[model samples]
Target: MLPDALPSRWYPIFSSAQLRRAPTVVERLGERLVLWRDAAGRAHAALDRCPHRGVSFKTATVNQAGELVCPYHGFTFSPKGPCAHAPVLGRDAKPPAMSLDIRNVTEAHGLIWAFTGAVEADTPPPPWFEGLGDDLRRCADIAEEWPVHHVQLTQSMLDIYHVGVLHRRTAPGSGQVITDFTMTTTEDEVHTEGRLGHEGAKGMPFVARLRLPGLVHLDVGFGLHVLVGVTPIDAKRSWVWARYEARLTPLPQLDGVIAWLGAKYDFTVLQHMEDLPLLKSIEPAVPEPGVDRLIAPDAGAAAYLRLYRRALSGRMEVAQ
Candidate 1:
């Protein structure tokens, strides 16, 4: 979870393919936002509420002049969000003092991002997925809306313990026992080093990295890397997006088909199906240490909470 007092941060609202000249509604960090692009293909983000009647402008449309026209009253607004026209008022008439509350928006790396917070504060650029660089070939992407809180969704990805049990059929760990857990935490990242199975029998060492606010990179070896990001839609809902990338597949031509099918079975059908029923069963949204008896395997979750607290205290300096 993010702290209220922290400065604005860029959060992904839509994939590049999802937004166009039409207004699209997206909820993030507990606020409803409207996203659209202009005739020049410039992107914009604003509060979905129309100032006049407090109705959502999500159903609004863009006019020939490239302004957002409210569906209820035909009040038009510029991309910067000041009122440009009103149906009842004449063309020469001056618009009222009301204006849409627009926020900072940017498009990059095949995603649309919005900066939400105080207007005067300078927001840092969105975090880059280092695993998306030239070294890896991004083969497939998928997103799922989970009923549980974003924190729970994040923890499930970091726990190596669930692999053997929850993913037995889909992931098939070959009866491997996971142990020898170690975790290191910094203000920005949590690094975990562990063994997959019991000592000497093909138990490959595993390394996982989690960046602040829930961006993950799992190095499963064999040129396979898994990237996961969780964006809070509200206190109870979240949008989880993941990308499967590989570098050295024996058959490059079939990589796309293989990645898509693997993600469908292992991620959606196996892992998430197993996690949903269990995570939703937890009583409180944010559970305390004593709520459940946690063992060594839960160190990753513990580290995540510690880092979250440091950030909440406003003591952690975010690198721009």
Candidate 2:
């Protein structure tokens, strides 16, 4: 089982393009959820079970009225989860005092975000990278399921020291030494700036930042930006959503080509050829505070762990 105290925040679980008019089922945050779109193309999320018969909503269908209809019976539910109609009770009969388990969801940044925390009147919009505006075009949108816990996967993303060593083959000439590394932690964010040292050469500078609840932004220069969302499918599995974007030239029409090339060479080669193998080999799958020895090079990851613990304990408010 996952930790009982997971931080209450919004998590991006599905790509916007993946959810169409048909109802789709997904396992996220250790719960089975049903996602669907209405006639107007808006998205809705709920527990993947019918309230009346406990039938899985995986086989449900969307009615013309934009309500979800259970396949077993004709019981219907609205996007917000209220029982809209019951075929057995007659068309004019009032619906029973029942409701589907509704989940708060919204669409932004080409992804569907679900609120894991309690829904309140003041629930904020999903967090996003500052410069990811309409000007930048997405080149690659990839989603992969990893067999390791989300905590470990997220920690690996923050651990910059592993790049030069683990990706040495794919990224030859990149040295294993890290120099001039500095990390800063705010209420709900951790920012790390560092340089990768190489023999007889000036180090390469990079900047990485993490937002609470598993949002990461990595900038390695050259107008390429990588954004990743690490969402837990369960205690032992995680879904990683990676978006590669670029604004290489003044011609917006050529943005896609630039982004595609960058993702093909950098993201694909590094993640598949080098990262996944090492990530799957981590022991215990989940990370424990005192189980491993962390060094100076791991300052960013260490700070993230501390902040994550605090968030899980409900001691800090997650910034939007």
**Candidate with maximal TM-score:** 2
Per model, how many backbone clashes are there? Answer: 0, 0
How much lDDT does each candidate structure score? Answer: 0.73, 0.81
Compared with the true structure, what per-residue lDDT tens digits does model 2 show for residues 9-45? 8899899988998899998988899999998999999
Q: List the residue pairs that clash in candidate 1.
A: none
Query: Where does the lowest 10-residue lDDT sum fall in candidate 2?
Result: 1-10
Using lDDT as the measure, which candidate wins?
2
In candidate 2 the C-alpha lDDT for residue 268 amounts to: 66
Off by over 4 Å in 2: 1-5, 133-138, 264-268, 315-320
TM accuracy, model 2: 0.91
Model 1: worst 10 consecutive residues (lDDT sum) = 1-10
Model 2 residue 240 CA deviation (Å) reads 0.8
